[model samples]
Every structure is written in C-alpha cells, then in structure tokens.
Target: MTDITSTELKQRQSAGNAPTIIDVRETWENEEGRIEGSQNIPLGTLPDKLDELEALKDQEIVVHCKGGGRSASAKAFLVQHGFKNVRNLLGGFQGYQQA
Candidate 1:
C-alpha cells in the first residue's frame, strides 16, 4: 500500500489528479469537519460498503480516519479485497487540517 501525505494530496488535487478520498471516521467525527469531496464510510462499515466502491477498484483510493491507525486498517482491507491502488492518508484528517 502507498502512503500519501496531506500536502501531496493537496498538490494532486490542485493538479486535477486527486485520488478518491475515503474517510473512515465515524458519523460524529465527520459531522465536525472533513476534507471536501471525501466519502464517509466509517471503518466498521467498510466491509458492507466495499460493493459501493467497486468502480474504484482500479483507481487510486486514499483512506483516512481521525488519526492514521484506522485508515491503515482500511487500506489493508481494501487491498485484501483486490483494490489495485489503495493508499493510507498519512496522519489522517488531523494531518489534513494541519496541512
């Protein structure tokens, strides 16, 4: 799996090559604040939501949580499910905010 820093993500976004962002934080956490255009699918629901993301299998998918841990797990899960390009957003939402 690849590790993407928030700054790199922002740069890619500005370049019009942004990857699909999947937020793994819970509802409440997401309600507070999140990166624009990110999809909220909490880690717990990822298994069930995998089908919804089938179209992204061959695309670059970047996963994030409040912190890095959960997103790492989420990335692993996607890789196991045959996602060709999955990445963990290093430092997650907090890092994005800082960026």
Candidate 2:
C-alpha cells in the first residue's frame, strides 16, 4: 500500500485536493478529535462496511488510526478488496498532530 505523511496530507487539504481520509480508530478514540471531513469506520467494522466505500474504489483513500497499525491493516484489506488507490497514513493521527 502507498503511504502519505501528515505534512503532505495537510498541503493537499489546504489545496482542496485531499484524498478521502478514513479513520479506522474505535468510537471512543474518535471522540477525542479527528481530521476534519474524515469518515470514521472502526477497523473491526470495515469488512461489513465495504459497501459504504464502493463508490470510492477508484479514488484516493488515506487511512489512519490512533497509531499506524490499524491503518496498515485496513489499507491492506482495502487493496485486497480491489481498492485501486489506497494509502496508509504513516504514524497515523499521532503523526498528524505532530505535524
């Protein structure tokens, strides 16, 4: 899967060309804060929610979690399921906050 840094994601967002950001963290974690416009689909529920992402199969998707683990797993799952343009946000939201 592809990887994108938080800084790069920020630039893309500022340019209004950001890819769809998917947060794979759990509901509790998401209550803290999330990147604006990100869609929350907990890692555990991703498989059942594949339909929600059907239309975005060909579009760019950036996935993240509290750290990088869940996002990596989610990205791999998406690719295996035929998502052509998926990425994992390295270091996840923690990395984003640092940037």
Candidate 3:
C-alpha cells in the first residue's frame, strides 16, 4: 500500500474514520507527542506483539515513527507476517506535527 501523508491522516482522523494507527517509536519518543488514539507498539517490539495483533491482520493499520524510516521497516515486517493491509505514515510523527 502507498504511504499515507500526514495531511491525509489528519483528514481521516477528523472525519472519525481513521485506521488503526501504531506509533513505532520508543516509548519516550511516543510520550513526547502522538496522534490522538494511536497505539504505541515500538518497531522492535512488533514481533513480540504479533499474537496481540492477530485480530487486526486484515484491518488497515498505519505505522509511524519519529521520521519515516522505522515505520517503513515495521510495515514490511507486518506484511511479511501475514498482515494484509499495513501502511507507513509518510514523514512520520514529525511530519504529522508539522502538518
């Protein structure tokens, strides 16, 4: 799936149709700021959280990090693990903040 821009994310959030958003940053980084309602799953921990996330396999999941790098890896990891609809958040939280 194509990455979602911060602007596009904000629009969906405002409309109350936002997808399941996962913040793939360190816990402290996520505590600094995060899109409301986004869950923190930190990139490195995604593998450990697979069972917990199993129910969401076919659901649309949006992943973000401090910038965009980690989230890209997270998206790829989830896809490799049988996730059918995972997307990266373009520019990540920094871009979302700027937007």
Candidate 4:
C-alpha cells in the first residue's frame, strides 16, 4: 500500500489539491477531532458505504485511523474494490496531530 505523510497532506490541502481523506476511526473517536474535511466512514461500515465512494474511484483517497493499522486495512479493501488511487496515512491521525 502507498503511504503518505501528514505534512504532505497538509500541503495538498493548503494548495486546494487535497484528495478525499477518509477517517476510518469510530464516531466517538471522531468527536475528539479529525482532519477538517475528512469523511467519517468507520472501518467497520466501509463495505456498505462503497457506493458512497464510487465517484472517487479515479481520484486520490487518503485513509487514516488512530494509527496506521486500520488505514492499511482500508487501503487494501479499497484497492480490492477497484479503487485506482488510494494511500494510507503513515502513522494516521496521531501522526497528523504530531506534525
């Protein structure tokens, strides 16, 4: 799976070129905070939400969670489902906060 740094994501967002960012963490976790424009679709429910993301199949997608594990799994699932461009945020949201 491809990996991207939080810094790179920030730069893309600032330049108005950010891809769709998916937060695979649970709702409760999201109450704390999340990337400003990230879409929350918890890992557990992604299978049912595939259609919601269909329009983004050809666009870049960045997935993240509390750490890298969930995002890796999400990336795999996306690729298997025919998503052409997907990347896991290395270190996930924690990394983003650190940055």
Candidate 5:
C-alpha cells in the first residue's frame, strides 16, 4: 500500500469521500486532537480488536499516530493480517495539522 499525504487526506475529507481512518496513538494522545472521523484504536490493542475490525479488511483504511512511526507499524500489521488496502498517513497527525 502507498502512504498518503496530509494534503491528499484533507482533499478527500473535504470531498466527503475519505477512506476509513484509524488513529493508532495512545488514548491520551488521541484525546489531544485527531482527524474528525478517525477511529481511535491504540496500537497495542489492535490484535484484540481484530474481530471488531474484520469488516474493514477489504476496505481502504488509513492509519496515523502523533508522528509517522506508530502508524507505519499499524499499517504493516494490518497488511500482514490480511487487510486488503491499508495506508499510513505520511507524517501523521502533526503533518495533517500543518497541512
């Protein structure tokens, strides 16, 4: 999967056709602020939420964290777990804010 830039995400969001977004940051970090409709699923809990996330396996999903690292890991995990379309938000939330 390719990485998506914040500018592209904002464009998709404004068009009301954004892909499903996953926030892989800690609960506290996520509470600080986040993409409007991104679902918060802390990285550590992803395995536990596999069942809950099963339905999205074939959907285009984007993952992000405070920066890019955690979300990169999340994207790799999802891909390994059979998710068909997963991408990391380039530069993550900070980048999104900057954009």
Candidate 6:
C-alpha cells in the first residue's frame, strides 16, 4: 500500500484532486472532527462493507483513523481485497491536524 503525508493530501485537496478519504475510526471518534468530505467506515465494519466499496476499487482511496495503526490495517485489508489504489494517511487524523 502507498502512504500519503498529510501535507501532500492537503495540497492535493487544494488543487481539487481529492481522493476518497475513508475514516476508519469509530463513530464517536469521528464526531470530534475529520478531514472534509471523508467517509466514516470503522475498521471493524469494513469487511461487511466491501461490496459498498467495490465501485471505488480502481479509484484512489486514502484511509485514516485516530492514530496511524488502524488506518494502516485498513489499507492492508483493502490491498489484499484487490483495491488497486489504496493509501494510508501517514500519521492519521492527528497528523493531518498538525499538518
């Protein structure tokens, strides 16, 4: 899986080349704040939601969570499931905030 820095992601968004951002954090965690336009799909529910994401397999997907761990797992899972353009948000949401 590829890794995308928060700064790089921010630049891409500003340039209007936004990838689909998937937040793998829990619902409560997402209630705090999230990158604009990101979709919430907790890591635990991802497997059951695979069909919902099938159409996006060929598109760029950026995954993140409260920290980096969960997103990393999500990225790996997507890749294993044949997602061709999946990326992990380096440092996750906290890092995005700092960036």
After superposition, which runs of candidate 2 have C-alpha atoms over 4 Å from their true positions? none
Best by TM-score: 5
Tell me how candidate 2 scores on lDDT.
0.94
lDDT for model 6, please: 0.95
Q: Which stretches of candidate 4 lie over 4 Å from their true place?
A: none
- Regarding lDDT, does 3 or 5 come out ahead? 5
Candidate 6 RMSD to the real structure: 0.7
Clashing pairs in 3: none
Q: What would the per-residue lDDT of candidate 4 be over residues 1-99, giving only the tens digit for each residue?
A: 468999999999999999899999999998899999998999999999999899999999999999999889999999999999999999899999998
Candidate 3 — worst ten consecutive residues by lDDT sum? 38-47
What is the TM-score of candidate 6? 0.97
lDDT of each: 0.93, 0.94, 0.94, 0.94, 0.95, 0.95
Estimate, for each residue in 23-54, the C-alpha lDDT of model 5 and write its tens digit. Answer: 99999998999899999999999999999999
Q: Write the per-residue lDDT of candidate 3 for residues 1-99, one digit (tens) a residue.
A: 888999999999999999999999999998888889999998888899999999999999999998999999999999999999999999999999999
Model 4: ten consecutive residues of lowest lDDT: 1-10
Candidate 1 has a TM-score of 0.96
Candidate 3 regions exceeding 4 Å error are none
Residue lDDT tens for model 2, 1-99: 459999999999999999999999998899999998899999999999999899999999999998899999999999999999999998899999999
Q: What is the C-alpha RMSD of each candidate to the true structure, in Å?
A: 0.8, 0.7, 0.6, 0.9, 0.5, 0.7
